[model samples]
Target: MITGLRYLNHSDALFTGKVPHQLGSLTNLQYLDLSWHYNRPPYRNVDNIDWLSNLSSLQYLDMSGINLTKVDIFNAITKLSSLSVLHLSNCNLKSIPVVLPYVNLTYLSTIDISENDVSSMIPNWLLGMHNLVSYNGISTDISKLIRDLSGCARYSLQRLKFHNNLLHGKLPDGLAMFSNLTELHAYNNFLSGCIPESIGSLSSSLMYLYLANNRLEDPIPEAVGELSELVVLDLSFNPLGGLISNSHFAKMTKLEAIFLSSSSVTVNMSSDWTPHFQLKNIRMGSCVLGPEFPTWLKAQRNKCLMQAFQLLYLTGFGTYLLKLST
Candidate 1:
């Protein structure tokens, strides 16, 4: 008859043993977080979360850092019709549940199952979760995953992260469908090919974009300038080529940080071109930064002081760029 349990957060509590089955008695519980042991394996492992089904009113559940490799996690949680947010990140899961088409998780707003060992293609049922807003499924085949996401959850997906995965192939053109998308992080993957020009379609809502440490090649897309709301743009450590002049960043007036280090990009711009944006951090090491010191650095002195700068190759002229203001 216990109906008033509402919140429980035992994250990092260092408690050992299995999750108590008695918790299922708290039918009114709304939020429960038992995250533990991130650097190492969790001390506790649950064979089944079948007890969770009894908590019909559960809206938020986070079992991150717990071992659920042997459990059918999806089947257990799908029964919680009121669930709005679910976080099972860093769990030792081997695969995503095969969801049936008839099953509907329409109320789920966010799902983070990142850092797992999931090796299967994203289940089709996931796409039916039309209310999904944010998803982080890191360490998977990027191309197939993005393709599936673009096809299924394009309209409702806003924040997507699949960093440090086995992602390859060009950035999909279908990404342009996410008009409501605000942030995208696919860094540290094996993604290659040019940045798709279709990404400009998200200019109105997109803010943060990171695709660093990939095999992406070709010139920076001119459409990138259309992202007027961009705050941080990192395309560093890639084989990106072609001239990246002021025109490429003409409309990125809100840009705060730009990272393009260790790339084959050439920054060909006028020495006196005063940029509209004031940057806080700019890393363009091993890049071609012109025959003369970039005059835009002077304009950033008063409005935004350069916090960090690392220039590995400043053209063959061997002349140090403009002295940055403290």
Candidate 2:
């Protein structure tokens, strides 16, 4: 008799059975996930809690792929004080569970417990979360997640995702006080430094900024071309070098996408740098695009209105392909 389960983790079954012994009458359950869908049915069920203390109107508590061990899931998620959103990505979580502020859920925002075996500090009681916008997975202290997101700047965050893991150092000095941060996904990790000339104070309705790969070297400054309503800018690979030009993004014109493959592998474009390499989703493969590369991809389809592209592996461009697909 599974009673009234509002939400049972591991994606609703596939190694799911326990925690169903009449689910303690559900008590008008709000949301309770036992966790497992590390991407669906990843299989993680050993001695289930069987009824989860008869959940008392749970808010949203994903057990986060429970392998248990961290004192048996933070002592049963601190007795679930109406949890809001807590998915500890991979189990094996090391720290950061200080009873989570007696979790009244208080309308919690988002918290993904990334990869696992967490470490690197960053549990300042989640800055007393006043409806946090995001507390992206795992630890590995990237300066304590920028000092708990610079005090979570009044928590009006728009978007934030800490991609990959192993976040090392650099790029976290108050992060412009989250002036209503739009999006900042710290890719890969092992973060070296650079790319923070106050990052232009971001938030011009900022749209996606990922520091790809890591070990960030020099060049990528120019205050990120003044982020004019920037839209998707991933600094590929790292080892940053010169000519990190943007010429002020040719007035940005609401740039769609632009990822400089090898920041500086040989790329020496100088036809007056041509209107600041106008973009509509470009990956700039191997740099050095001197030759008649379709006259610079038909001059980026003569400026805008281009649609969808990937343009992978460049270099003396062969096995050609550049179908702007209308």
Largest lDDT belongs to which candidate? Answer: 1
Q: What TM-score would you give candidate 1 relative to the actual structure?
A: 0.88
Local distance difference test, each candidate: 0.79, 0.62
Model 2 bad stretches (over 4 Å): 1-15, 21-33, 38-60, 63-81, 86-105, 111-132, 135-155, 158-178, 182-223, 227-232, 235-258, 261-286, 289-326
Worst lDDT 10-window in candidate 1? 316-325
Residue 324 Cα positional deviation in candidate 2, in Å, after optimal superposition = 38
Candidate 2 per-residue C-alpha lDDT over 1-326 given as tens digits, one digit per residue, 9 for 90 to 100? 35555665444455653434455577667776767655555456435553555675677777667665424555555566677677767766566655453544456677777777766565656566667776676656666666665665344665667778767878775676777677888888888878777877673756678888888887666676677777788888887776644353534556677776765634444444544345666776665454444344444543343222223333423333334433
Candidate 2's TM-score reads: 0.31
lDDT of 1 by residue, 53-101 (tens): 9988899999988889777888888788899899998888888866653
Clashes of each: 1, 3
lDDT of 1: 0.79
